[model samples]
Target: MVKEYILLIIGAVLVNNFVLSRILGICPFLGVSKRLDTAMGMGAAVIFVMTLSGFVTSWCDKYILVRYNLEYLRTIFFILVIAGLVQVVEVLLKRFSSTLYSALGIYLPLITTNCAVLGSAIICATEEEFMGRIFKSTVFCFASAVGFALALVLFSSVRERLELSKIPRSFQGPAIALVTAGILAMAFTGFAGLGS
Candidate 1:
């Protein structure tokens, strides 16, 4: 059991990263990653919502949806669950960390519908390739969030430096950023077999 979850975590965080490899949640990935602090805030918010939604969605799928033969409703169900969970995270952040709340700006609330969060829940709950168990899904979700954070932070650091460096007039802003992202994606591809 432990080894299974360990491999799942490794796979989730490295082999199948939601952002770098799966190409999910590109909005926040580019929008908030300009600043390291904002990226961290967004990453933490995603971690909270993704992990909690993973657990909730898994339980719902197993005990409620499957029991009632309502598997078709899993998508809607997970969306509602993740949206509500994102609200909770927003509230907590507003209460405890006003600075981060302000830093996150619009991207914070955008997490409610982030495809990565929803995908994590849906994939973990329904994908036959995964364990389809609550614990494994939760672990995968957490690791995936961590992987997202890792990638975001790294990119943000490089982007920060890019801000200081001079570049040709043609490749400023998004063009350069996209080029950097391509390089990062290629680097992440090296981790392909670790999860296996």
Candidate 2:
């Protein structure tokens, strides 16, 4: 059980990383990664939301979706849950943490609808091995979020450096980012056997 949990964490975080391996959330990977500050903010927001949504969706999948035969509604249900959760968090941040709210202002809303967020929930729920070993919902959520944060922050740093490099005319902006992401993803391939 211990080995299983450890492998699951390692696999999810690196081998099957949201950005590098799965290629999820590429929009923000390119868009928010232009600046370290915004990228860090976005990464933090993703970590919070993904972690929260993972636990919520995992519970829903276990207690509601599977039991009620609503597995077909996974996509819609996960999206709704994530959106509502982000909205609630955003509201609370607005009232109490104005600086945080502003830092996360638009990104929060964007992540609310981010397919990557929804995808992580759905994937985590379906992976019986992951669901079975994930004793605490909070741990599952936090692990997923941490993995996402790790990928985003790493990509952001790479992109920040790429900005100062001399690239070709054709591969200037998004193209360059995409190529860089591909290389990063390739590098992450080394982690494939880590947790298996």
Candidate 3:
């Protein structure tokens, strides 16, 4: 059991990373990664939302949705749970970290629609290995969110460096960023078989 859990963590955090590997949260990966600080803030917020939503969505799926044969509504129900969690995160950030709050701006609220969060929740709730197991699913979600944070932080650091380096005009701005992201994604694929 311990080994299985460890492998699961390795799988989620690297082999199946929601950001780099699975490519679920490209919006924030690109939008909030301009600054390391803001990227960290967004990563922390996503970790909180994804982890909590995993717990809530798992319980709901087991005790409510699956029990009542309402599995078809999983997407809608999961979105509602994730949205509420994002709101809570937003409120807390606004009250305590005005700087990060302001920096995040639209991207912060956009967490409500971040497919990575919703994808993690859905995976936790529906994956056969995680079904009826809230703890395992929550752990998976946390690992996945950590993976997202890892990718965001690394990418932001690269982007910060890119801001200084000279490049051809045609390769500047989003063009270069996309190329960097692709290379980063390729690098992540080196971990493809690690968990196995």
**Most accurate candidate by lDDT:** 3
User: lDDT of each model, Cα atoms only?
Assistant: 0.84, 0.78, 0.88
Per-residue lDDT of candidate 1, residues 35-56 (tens digit): 9988887888788777888888
The candidate that wins on TM-score is 3
Off by over 4 Å in 1: 92-108, 129-132
After the best TM-score superposition of candidate 3, give how far the Cα of residue 77 lies from its true spot, in angstroms.
Answer: 1.1
Sequence-dependent TM-score of model 2: 0.89
Relative to the unseen true structure, what is the C-alpha lDDT of residue 34 in candidate 2, on a scale of 0 to 100? Answer: 79
The number of clashing residue pairs in model 2 is: 0
Candidate 1 has its poorest 10 consecutive residues by lDDT at 124-133
Give all TM-scores, in the order shown: 0.89, 0.89, 0.90
- The C-alpha RMSD in Å for every predicted model, in order, reads 2.3, 2.1, 2.5
TM-score for candidate 3, residues paired by index: 0.90
